[model samples]
Target: NKLRVGLLFGGRSGEHEVSISSARAIAQAISSDQNAQKYELLPFYIQKDGYWLAGEIAQQVLTSGTPLQLNGSNIQLPNPSQTSLPIPTSPYLPVSSSSSSAQVADVDVWFPIIHGPNGEDGTVQGLLQLMQIPYVGSGVLGSAMGMDKIAMKMAFAQAGLPQVKYMTINRAQVWSNPCVFPKLCDQIEATLGYPCFVKPANLGSSVGIAKVRSRSELETALDNAASYDRRLIIEAGVVARELECAVLGNDNPKASVVGEITFESDFYDYETKYTAGKAGFLIPAPVPESVSSAIQEMSLQAFASVDAAGLARVDFFYVEATGEVLINEINTLPGFTATSMYPQMWEKSGVPFTELVDQLIQLALERHS
Candidate 1:
């Protein structure tokens, strides 16, 4: 019997489009002749408004490369004054008389391609956990740690991994204390100094990240980052080559060849990252064997530090002049788009995209058992 694989994508996060691209790539690979006889692909798309669309609708989104429009009359705007969180609903359960729980429950395994907040930050992982279904990528703990930059940094620190100096701020503190924002800016200037990066602690895709070189830019960056997530992370900028390594497995994770990211932009921002031709990659980065070995070792350590499983991509900052390799961050659920580094790195390391997805699904089943 063919193994049924539920492919989840398109999310409420800013990386929704990127997730769709990833799902398209994954679906093509899974449906390819190489593995078509072994697996059945079942797609599930989560709408931008957090509604779940399955069956033909989900398949159409993947085929058309467009998201389904939600009915305006059915949309409900949140209460501006409401402070309490809304009770969560299971996307796998039947939503109406026309829907069936078996659509999700009968799946042999799940492959989640959601790249940011609501999907990648452990919410979907927790749901899959509750369902007792085998799913790809990291578990609840790893996903949560990987998504939150502040928590991820703390985990890296606990593991004694070398990383750039950074500080965190809470939106609530900035809004309630009034003096907190200025105090944070003062501390950042005095410590990390000018030319630092401000990022939303829980977001990916560089959605709310900014490089600030002055107090004015710093204030603006903070406000911008705060709009996406409550926690904000400010990191000291460094002049170094950005290198990434892909890690795969559970108890014994293996790191792939190092890949360097070169961009003309000031930094690897959203545009530089997603826009084809804007960024270039040097596979098997021309670093010394020793440097490559060190990066590979650090990548495995970073993966284990976050308790990541199935797959992850660990980024680093390598300073050639100083011979310093600083850990940037680990992405448990890294992008799977055609230009994404994770699959590319693995491909350079002898695993093709189709085989990589096959291995990931196998790993998911292994982990579940």
Candidate 2:
């Protein structure tokens, strides 16, 4: 029998739409493959309002080509011994013994493509762990650590990785004592200075991220980011090229060819990242071989530092004037959208999309074994 693979996406995150786009891409890719007969694809979508969907409803929601609507029946998380997808709990819907009962999607492995909070921060991974199902990407610890910028930075520092100067801010402190806000500002100016980036420590896809060049902007940015996550992070800005490399595998991960991103926006934000024609990429980033080698080396080191598995995209800031390569951040579940850098880099490095997907699935199975 073919290996059954469950594809999970459409999370309750700020990146919900991005996740849907990624899911659509993966489905299309898998459907068009000549070797698709080697495996059975089972799609599972988590609605934004916290509904677990599968069966014909999921198939319709995914293929309708319309905005994601909450149209599926209620379902819950499965138990380890269940050996099947979550059992639907609602009774209002009509059911026929065989014609109307909800379908059960049992799989040998799970491929979670959900990005951002509840999904990417390890909550879903933890649930799957309890279910004893093998899933793609990082585990609970790595996913949790990777989702929080403060914790991720600490791990990188522990590994002796060079990164931009950064500081963490607690939302509670600012909200409790209004006077403490000014002191926090002074501290930020003293440490990171102006032209810094403020971001929610736990979210990704550039959600709740701001580039502030003045005190007023800093305060507003901090407040905005605080609204998303309790822990906020501020980093000193750097005028350097944005280079990214794809790392794949578990114990012995390999880095793909380096790629660079350039855009007219103040920074690479959500729009530039997901919107086509908004940002430009330089494949085999026009840098010296030494710089490329350094990025690759650092990428592998960063992957090992976080104990990442399956796949990850390690980003770096290459300062031309100083010739310094500083680690930016590692995305455990980097976007697989058409405009994403992770798969693009790997494709340029000679790994086609279909082959990359096959390798990742095999890696997931290998890790479980």
Candidate with best TM-score: 1
For model 1, the stretches where C-alpha displacement exceeds 4 angstroms are: 71-102, 176-180
User: What digit string (tens of lDDT, one per residue) describes model 2 on residues 1-369?
Assistant: 877777788877878777877777777666655548877777776777765665555555567633354442342323312222334742111122333213233667888898988888888888778768788888898888888899999999999999999999888855757888888999999999989999989988898899999999998998889898899999999999899999999999999999999999989998888788999999999999999999999999888888889999999999999999999998899898755788899999998877788788888888878
Error of 1 at 125 (Å): 0.3
lDDT of 2 at 240: 91
- lDDT assessment of candidate 1: 0.86
Q: What is the lDDT of residue 112 in candidate 2?
A: 89
**Which regions of candidate 2 fall more than 4 Å away from where they truly are?**
71-105
Each prediction's RMSD to truth:
5.0, 4.5
Candidate 1 residue 80 C-alpha distance from true site, Å: 29
Relative to the true structure, candidate 1 has a C-alpha RMSD (angstroms) of 5.0
lDDT of each: 0.86, 0.81
